[model samples]
Target: MLLRQLEYLVALARERHFARAAEACHVSQPALSEGLRKLEDELKVLLVRRGRAYEGLTPEGERIVRRAQRLLADRDALREEATALRTGLSGTLRIGSVPTASGAVSLLTDPFCAAHPLASVQLRTDLRAEEVLRRVRDFEIDAGITYTPDSTEGVRTHPLYEERYVLLTGASEEPAAHPNVTRPNATRPNATWAEAAELPLCLLEPGMQGRRTLDEVFTGLGLAPRPRVETDSVASLFAHVRTGRWASVVPYAWLHVFGVPPGMRALPLVGPVHGAPIVLVLADRRPGPVMARALLEVARRTDAATVLERLP
Candidate 1:
């Protein structure tokens, strides 16, 4: 019934193990379990499925957990509203961002923190589009940096910028590298998504939104890329490409943050596959006073033009 109980429940759901969840909440396992029991008793519903080990939440338990998450979010918003009214501003802001956009995460945080030095920021780099929406709805994260499939409901988006896919290859003229091509920009040995798909490629894991988009583009062209390697980290992807044998598809903006190695050249994916837009998404629900204003300020500064100009 109390917000603290709901907080414990959320942590438990995230961690899946009672002891670890309790540790995260800075409480003993017994205390955390007792709180959850009391919450179930108050609501008159079973909120957890207990066995020899933690199994999972019951159907009703799952429902309650979702509601509890929203309730806690509302509570935090109320407190933020009151505090902002009393003082100028001060509170924690949690941000979730897709792995690709993780590079640009600081673009919003740096300025926001500079203006409101008292506020704290919690950043989560490993996020999917659906996960971002769920956290934002539950008030877990204040906002997110994600790409568009525009599938998530109950969220508003602010366009950050469009991203063009680029090929990354090593510096040396290794024969192992794909043969050089004469495009408008032929100084670099590069190919379009269709062209690259013909050769061995390194790509992100399939589930990631970035990979999905790349796949869609490749599939649309009736081409299936043969990946020599796959991974979750952009750094690792570039590192592999730097070796000269592998090449990867990356957003142009990424080249700016993780600079292309001296031996590497980034050629834009042209011909059939152009690019896609990235966005900053936030919950449609009102935020706490301090966080609400801060969220708007972030959205204001991260407009399409600002981000586009920074793209490689």
Candidate 2:
């Protein structure tokens, strides 16, 4: 049918509410319903199961929605391809990043924008690894910065940097303050994972990717961090550490731009772990969108690790 009809279907799938889907499509509820009805009639299938409210899509509807997503993606790619040929790279580069890599994502985008001045970036740093991969495959985002496994089937990855962990804490006054290793003397000052776990901590919520990484490392060392405060925001973690009441284990990259929060210290977490490889992952579609491939190229050529490692 029409591309407009496909857009309506995709919006419906995403929103799952007739009124909300209509709102997303920027059309009235009646118009959205009429468009879907026309699409179903043209395809000769019962696409949606309707009730008092917006019921779920049929099996056939789900398949068609998947195809619809791809069709819309291809349409957008064609337009972007044409624009790139006329000018240089243009349009917004939509990037989804795992929370742990959020602070370091600018390391990739800053250079990307400088090189292609016409191209803008839309950065979403509030996604998990699985969600980032899912959006990439669905053509929802142009690229993602994440800590990935060795291989993901339909995604192409470029290793951007290795994320090292550090213990962020207040001034060392108390007896159990992980042995006040001064920043000047120790060079790369370090604290054992056990020492970090013993402190009253404020950590990311259990569901967050960064928290899970810390949890895995702690588990490996037979240590479980029972945080006094749990948060979904990295900023909040820093706030708690600044209070001198809570300590946290965080990616060292986070301190590159802002440095450790005032009245706090960042010590490398020592023992039983290598750094996490943060990578740029995107869908592996052949002749993928020009914008996505361009981002991957930026990742390949960029020295994000060097910049992220340079603490303020």
What C-alpha RMSD separates each model from the true structure? Answer: 2.9, 2.9
Q: Model 1 off-target regions past 4 Å?
A: 177-190, 287-289, 310-312
How high is the CA lDDT of each candidate model?
0.77, 0.83
Q: RMSD in angstroms, candidate 1?
A: 2.9
Candidate 1 lDDT over 1-312, as tens digits, reads: 488898999998889999999999999999999999999899899989999878899999888888877777777778887887787568888889888878777778887888787788899988876788777766678887888745657677777777777877655544544466322234654467666776557899899888998999888889887787888887788888877677778877786587767777787777765767878777776543358568667668655446646655
Q: Please give the clash total of every predicted structure, in order.
A: 1, 0
- Report the alpha-carbon TM-score of model 1 versus the true structure: 0.88
Q: Give per-residue lDDT, candidate 1, residue 221.
A: 84
TM-score for all models, in order of appearance: 0.88, 0.92
